[model samples]
Target: MNPARALIVDLPGPDLTLEEGRFLARHSFGGVCLFARNITTPERTARLVRDLRDALGHDALVATDQEGGAVLRRLDVPHPPTPMGLGALRDPEAAREAGAVAARGLLDLGINWNFAPSLDVNVNPGNPVIGERSFGSDPALVAELGVAWALGSEAAGVMSAVKHFPGHGDTQVDSHLDLPTVNKSREALEACEWLPFRAAVRAGVGSVMTAHILYPALDGERPATLSPAVLTGLLRGEWGYDGVVVTDAMDMRAIADRYPGGVGAPLTLTAGADAVLVCGHGELTPHAEHLNAVERALRDGTLAEDRLQEALTRLASAARRFPGTPRPYTAAERERDGAQVRAWARASVTRVGQVPRLSPDAEVLLLTPDQPGVGGPYGDSLGGDELAATLRAYFPRLRHANYSPTDARAARALLDEFPGAPALLATPTRWNLTPVQKELAGLLPARGGIHLALWNPEHARALPLPALVSYGFRPAHLAAVAQALITGEAPGVLPLAAPEVV
Candidate 1:
């Protein structure tokens, strides 16, 4: 075959265009990674994928970042608990079940590849990008739960790409905008960041997605995706991982800012990346240009033929390994998953210290951050709408305001108008605390205030007790926080150590 599926491109929307079909045929693309916009419903997504494959006239992978909680492509459907929530549950069997269920849904949508089960150990409280995606801070726990999740996914025939390999959890910078540096010594990396990945490989994860982070200890200059030392030497040579290695989105500033004109495609292939991901809807380079650039690299010997064939082999082997048995998630499965998620919220949300109840007759103000648009990467970060809808049931007079740093002064003034009314500040993310979240929680009067850390328990300590760490902002999790604030009855314990639970 003259064409080898070496590239993974994204679609512009749910329906593939004629130009898109032509592009797929021209280059023999390996796969398409669908975003939220491409997924409206299971029926529509399945049709779109079928049409895509008919155009190619070849087998191709369909993927999405369907990791539960924060990054779900199918938002309309019920999902199991996030990795952090599952980590709190500490039941590897439960983690495996979540993975199996997610895989089934993905297969129903005609998706076979899932970029998920982040093996990153989130030890840094300041990591902006990977707060709740990780299973937990402890490497051992992350390894156990992550492997269980991955094994479950693979067993169900949907391959899991355990990601941001060589770790993206310890950095402060978001790779979407810039490259982050992880300054840990090799020894420290071995102890923390590398453990879960090692475990994933040992447990036979099908794929690994390389991080866009720079580890100076591994390679002095280049980021992991472009560094042979990290990808080829460490991952392939040392760890004996012969599976496919997919680079994270090439459009991200971490890669794009450094390599212009789609030159990174050849560089990544040279470095051991199997798939060159140039995402649609936000790609910088023209489609033809990326293909042209790779062709030129080949002509110039920058990309060796053997290297190209080797990468293709790995990608092909993955499809053969996890040829899924596709089945739609039944209505019963949806309700079952919904109940499991609700149970998780009930069992994992932590109440710190004595949470004071607000009088039903008193005025109450809830400050929250806004959720990103449905297609954005952090779409579910702030489920403020979900939280407010639930909280309104408890406090009839409750007024909710989406606040930014500019609204800090107004939020404080709004609190003063109520005199003795309690003001509640809720943050669904830890490292991602918006400026307004920090300022308003600080501005609230020490006595008549409630702070809810909806994602992590430690971040709740930023304010005072009388706070609840709900561990998530899903409808069920936020409902528990709403119930706890009004009745002082949060029952879930923190996955991590925390202060007294009310």
Candidate 2:
């Protein structure tokens, strides 16, 4: 019963440290998960992954969150638009191509497991975390796009993990911060949240990531991550998901705040999760302490040995599916992927109301905020820089005012200064915005000539203003929104129900 071989751990830096290598060898850990801190260049990342595998003395599942939207790991890669952006394009095939591109990038970095294709049906409009990261509000669209991605990634020789199941899309709380509870009945879940997972399983997804949310209808006490009813009974027995079940990061507050040290590891595995993801941001506890807990559980007959073997078998089987060597990519392939991504961006930017055509001499007031540098549904590196530059290109007399969303005084002063001047207000709706930013969004249109540019379209219903929902914060998306605003031509049809305000 090698519990270490069933655990997936994270590195603290770009290079494979001797300590990490010794830990991997000592415990026979299943894999190493990478982050931005561990990825500097493709060449370096490939070497680091190879080094880690060498230390394990066996092929391990090298994984990373290569989900292209805001949850990007490799900074140099051409980050594709978000899942919602692809949904807006109404082309699942484009999603497949995007998945292939994302897979190729991962494979090039010697990463095998692509923890992506989030199958969560974003049913709740106010969901803080899984809003725009979801494909759309519709379950059918989410399933179609998710299955396409899984198949496409498989084709690229990279394993795909359709994530956060039973579903994390309905809750207002981020499981990273706290454990959220879902009150939906089994029938409700089947019609909405369960649809995508069922579809992905049928499509032969290599893995399913467990959510940290609790559902009283399923397991009243345990979260899905540690619930046999959800993990074994429902996912395996009912849905027949024979693939690997991964925990959403063990270090997250949802799991950590409740279960200390390695307590959650054996519990989740016993609950039917095949692999536990103990990915610390930088600092990781000693693997011996965690491995000892697992060893103790098996020794005391608390965790079944057969269950541990089953997990190891599944992990090894998934690792074997990936190519032994990372395939090389050419300039042509990169260019082709970039072109497809740009085309998708152009098709996905949804516009609402008439964007007043600004003359070169028109005084344009640009109200932009600082970029949300964090990852997830809310923020990415790609922010107002491209939009500001693009807007300035069109409007020669553009004036810039950068303020925090919470700055009411600044917002009032700016509104007073540029009253009725055609203003381009770029605001992020979902997270990190202050009360002033949210308030300013509602207050801007009444001041006139305010064309609201939503960074996150989920907030569209909340803000009753004529707006342009760009779907994402990429530079390509900025260009697409600019085109829609200038030409009044957007091919995107809302994949979900259009907001009544729009």
User: Which prediction has the highest lDDT against the true structure?
Assistant: 2
lDDT of 2 by residue, 397-436 (tens): 7777777655666546766887877666777445655665
* Per-model TM-score on C-alpha atoms: 0.91, 0.94
Estimate the lDDT of model 1: 0.78
Residue 497 of model 2 has an lDDT of 64
Write one digit per residue (lDDT tens) for candidate 1, span 31-135. 888888789867788888887676654367778888887777877667656788787778899899889878877887778899998888878766777867888
**Over 4 Å off in model 2, which ranges?**
373-387, 411-415, 418-420, 446-448, 451-454, 498-502
Which 10-residue window of candidate 1 scores lowest in summed lDDT?
371-380
Query: Against the hidden true structure, what lDDT does model 2 obtain?
Result: 0.79
Summed backbone clashes in each candidate are 0, 1
TM for candidate 2 is: 0.94
